[model samples]
Target: MNKPYVIIHTHTSIDGNLDIMDLQAFEEASRQYQELSLDPEKQQFEIQGYLNGKTTTEDNITHYKRPELDENAAPVPEGDYVADPDAPMYYLAMDTRGELAFEENTFGYGGVPSHIVVALTERVSNAYKDFLRKKKISYIIAGKEQIDYDVMLDKFYNLFHIKRMMVGGGGTLNWSIVQNGLVDEVSVILAPIANADPDGHRFFVAKDPYSSIEETSFQLKSVQELEHDTLWIRYSVKKK
Candidate 1:
């Protein structure tokens, strides 16, 4: 936790799926989260989706209601829909428990980092806070107010002094951190599978090209295999 250094670690298939089904990465990330998770309900929720939004009279919630991405916002670099630039990081996922609030596909790995710090708007619900807290996780709700990213990064660095911070994200979170040039390293795990859904999230670039690093590079540290014929590779991102 010397200073807030960022590392983007993600696993994707050639078909473009991102889930814990890639056993090695899944087990590694989960072992860490499991060690820290204290709440049984929250841990159970990881296996299922935590309920959000409206509930029916039968105490069941509907699935397949995909939230709309903001139109006024810029599209993702890969040219997919994007959210309001000012919006709290929209997690395009269901809770780990997989209870069903949105789509009903059994995808997503929800492994909590040592500290899952979220930069969200004040509009985030109390239930959301409770859910994270139940897992013994801490959060930073930037509130409806926008925080100076640099200042907030410094605070996170100072607060946790986390030696190595791994950022496992969907897309925008990765883009924002990379665009800001705050990341020190990045690890992209390319799985040999693909998703025919073009609208489904792409690994990185979508439309506009992002800023490039003149000296950005990585050194391979290790490579291993996981259950189900998956692979685990490690790289040390060259520090700028």
Candidate 2:
């Protein structure tokens, strides 16, 4: 990792559910998320980019044709491509299985930089590589079977020049990064209510059955109230 700092940022209810089913609550949090997210001074890092897990990225995709992978084909040459040197980069998706179908290299988002990068494992097929090569979208590969989080981050640092990235996505992706000892800060917009949904995801979930959340320590960095009674809190993940 060239410049090693990552903040796992999320918005969750008081009860720790990510379901966020209520439309009103979703809209409010989203508004606050944008405000807090773009504030460069507070975060202490100009977010060169951000990330999304497969589920989070796939959820927003409307639908499109997917590419076929040829298992025997050579791996795509390792590299990066920026549409515009100054255009902001957003939503680097962890699509290790080569599942996403991008219509173009740069897809515009609401006032924010609209760009995408597909993170891949070495196992991704050659045909898919050809598809990505044709599309001219940016991509990086890490582990052989699964994405090596550390290597992936290094690619961002070395190739894309992303020093500090905002880890913006679901628990699985967040937890994987945390478990790899890559997370420095746990930032959240604490919603006022304790909305419950048994089906909803938690702030963090361990992959190993024996792994304990209690064992992972954190020191509260700062706390402040936002416009809508939403609390912005930052916790520094304490290392052993």
Best by TM-score: 2
Writing each residue's lDDT as its tens digit, candidate 2 over 142-239 gives 77777878788887777776767888768777777777778888998777766577778877866653134546788999998877778888998888
Candidate 2 residue pairs in clash (backbone atoms < 3 Å): none
Quantify all predictions' global Cα lDDT against the true fold: 0.40, 0.71
lDDT over C-alpha atoms for residue 178 of model 1 = 62
What's model 1's overall lDDT? Answer: 0.40
Over the stretch 20-59, how does candidate 1's per-residue lDDT look in tens digits? 4535554554443332222344431121111111211012
TM-score for each of the candidates: 0.45, 0.85
TM-score for predicted model 1 compared with the true structure: 0.45
Q: Which stretches of candidate 2 lie over 4 Å from their true place?
A: 1-3, 39-45, 62-65, 68-87, 107-110, 208-214
Assess candidate 2 and give its TM-score to the true structure: 0.85
